[model samples]
Target: MTTMFRYPVFPVLPGLGQTDIPEGLSRVRSIMAEPDYMDGDSDELIKPKKLLNPVKSSRNHQDLHRELLMNQKRGLAPQNKPELQKVMEKRKRDQVLKAQKEEQEAHKKRSDLEIELMKRRETLEQLELDQHKDDEEQENTPEFVKMKSNLRRTKQEVDGQERST
Candidate 1:
């Protein structure tokens, strides 16, 4: 029995107007002239010179240098995983603190909004009370004589019934 693992390798090609290259790969050659789209037959042909350029390696070296500097600063005595863990822990703690601060600010905003709503409600209640008073005064005016006469008639009916009883 044979166990075989075959991984599909997909070549990332450049778009219509540009050449496809890895993220850090720098093309020293000017892209003034565009290459013709290679047909299926020409796809198998590998140009050694084109593949030999280490533009990506140059970028990786820079990233490696940066990592080295960070390690030096943290005094990561080579292969010591504890220091890396400490750095990661510190980062997590910082993120948590930042999130907590944001939450506190959100809470404060909600409280301020609640206070404003309460104040508006009080103002609306006062306005309603003032409007009610105005309505009462209007009802008492001379033009409201019909309503006053109706009330007197009802009172007379009640008094006459009481005397008869």
Candidate 2:
């Protein structure tokens, strides 16, 4: 037995291989193809021959240069007088206040820790005293003494029974 199959093939269009070029790109290409285009004589092209001089300022260059040198030597840029000083003083005051607050907090913590330690020591001493009192009370009790003797007697009786068995 033989199986036969047919596949469909689409025909290629005439304009399918052509792409639409933009008008600007075509104009740019035509301009670039001209022999005199790179000479930069046209107003549309930029010229590198034009030199732009820096605008002259009213201030003296030597003074500005000396000020820059001084600022560099000082390791800081020139700032307004009262405003910068006030800001620096405020920062220093804030730092000092923060340090004082931290020191006070640390001192309070230490005091609290010491107080807690003292309380714990007192509680431990009280517990020890109570334990000592309990021990003395137990020693003085007739019931505890009787229980000790009864335990010894019971142990002897159990040993005798085990030997007989």
Candidate 3:
């Protein structure tokens, strides 16, 4: 003998594969839809939610940090300065201007020094060339030796006078 119930108050989905449901959801949904279902605790029905963009929230926090730092340096919020603040600003500006002028003067002095060094280098090179030419011309000339001796004596006398003064 077979016993059949007239109406299943909540339908019992047959173990799956005998229905119109999609393959993926067939097993899970069937179990869930069971009338006498007690799979586990009731709370497990809902999925554990998560944020899609954690960095987006961090980006907002970064904006707050930037605002805080900016406010700290430039008085509160909108850059409004009191009378003393204005005076301090003017003082700072004056100091910066003075520093810039000093820097310009230093640069000018450096350029002048470089120019003087170049000129001295050129003069030294010219003197070396002249001495080399004189040496070449003196190979057979006796007067060249006499002239060199006189020049050496003159240089020594001038150095002696400078040292004394």
Candidate 4:
């Protein structure tokens, strides 16, 4: 799409005349024409390359080379295990895992036994409490109260006879 540039036109009321600059106004330079914004020297534009310490790097490489050579002398070889070694390692790992599983099972059984004993103790305590309440209820019955009163009367009568004698 093309755009049509439109500018405002002036009538008699808008017929503006040339006006002089304001009393305090002065012409100023633009930032684009300043020296700082212009192209610089090629030498200044291209940065200098960084220097590296090749001697230190070579020393590190030499030390690593010597260490590898000494490791070969010390019989500290890299691991490329034979089939028999691999099989032995696998069996060792399996044994360790089986032992761990057995330990977990034993711990589970012990915890289960503890839980069962705790429940049994709670049930026994509840039964004893129920028995105590039943005994209290029985004592509160009319027959038990009458029996208790009769025993008290008989004891008093015996004491009175003994005193008279």
Candidate 5:
């Protein structure tokens, strides 16, 4: 069944298609050229579309692509923001902080006064209670209030009296 190995190994004949090597290569057998697509038993036609034609990149192309990617993180920007930032830096370097501190102190004082006023303001219920508790207005006249404040005894005199008692 095997064609290559037979009962008797066929001797090389010079009359065949294969040619003998020259005198220098007495033991060497005949050589063969590389097999071609046209020589194969398969009769399939070549398909150019199925063939691969990949593009190869050199070092320069790869380096250019890497640089492009590295630089594309952001686009070009106007210089206005940098100028404004410089202005802000100048403001920080100037006495703007002192002015801001003064404004903050004034704001704190105003807020404290507002809180005191809110505490002094009477609610509707308190107002009604005051109205009903005394139908007649009390000794709340401005002159009477001023007289009471002026005639009020000194704290030292009151303390001496308490000690004597």
Candidate 6:
């Protein structure tokens, strides 16, 4: 048996044309829309944005760093005397002096080591000279020559004994 109740279907409506607009709701277009209400003069009153020129275009960090470095170079970075600033300056001075003292000590140690090395080298040279002089004297001595000949004669006698045995 067929069902008598049916599902409802919705119909699609066409879009409204331009002429379909109501006269009471007509669209308006302005020729001079208030010129965007610019605050250019107020911007001039404010601090200008720091622009990195082509000559210094690589300065990508903040301008404050450059300003501080320049001021420090000119000895103007530090403000009016505060106890903390005085303490920091004193600390820096102490650290610099300490570093200088340590460097001097290191230099002194290096100089002492050099002197010791020179003394050792001189002693070695003196020993070498004494050895050379002893060698020259031994070469010139008749007793040394006779002893060498005796050693050779003993070695020959031992060789002859070994061959005979």
Give the clashing residue pairs of candidate 2, or none: none
- lDDT (10s digit) by residue, model 5, range 1-165: 866854433346667533444435434333344445656665685634654434335677777667766666665333446677898898886778888889899777777778777667756668888887665544444677666665675666788899999
Model 5 regions lying over 4 Å from their true place: 1-43, 49-56, 74-165
User: Which residue pairs clash within candidate 3?
Assistant: none
- Please provide, for model 2 over 1-165, each residue's C-alpha lDDT reduced to its tens digit, 9 standing for 90 to 100: 996657432333466422343335553453344556576677776555855445433357657777889998989766557687899999999999999999899777787779899899999999999999999988788997879989999999999999999
Off by over 4 Å in 1: 1-110, 144-165
Better of 1 and 3 by TM-score: 1
Q: Give lDDT per model, in order.
A: 0.75, 0.75, 0.77, 0.74, 0.63, 0.73
Kindly indicate the candidate among 5 and 6 with the higher TM-score.
Answer: 6
Q: What is the lDDT of candidate 1?
A: 0.75
Give the top-scoring candidate (lDDT): 3
- Clash-forming residue pairs, model 5: none
Residues 114-160, model 6: lDDT tens digits: 98988999999999999999999877889878798899999999999
lDDT of 4 by residue, 23-130 (tens): 343333311234542555554555557787687469888897788789899999855887799999999999999999998997777877788998999999999999
Task: State the number of backbone clashes in model 2.
Answer: 0
lDDT of residue 79 for candidate 1: 69
Per-candidate alpha-carbon RMSD to the true structure: 21.4, 17.1, 20.6, 18.4, 26.0, 21.7
State in Å the error of residue 145, model 3: 9.2
Residue 71 of model 6: what lDDT?
93
Model 2 residue 151 lDDT score: 99
lDDT of 3 by residue, 69-138 (tens): 8888988775466779999999999999999999899777777778899899999999999999988877
Comparison by TM-score, 3 against 5, better one:
3
Please count the clashing residue pairs in each candidate, in the order shown. Answer: 1, 0, 0, 0, 0, 0
Model 6's alpha-carbon lDDT is 0.73
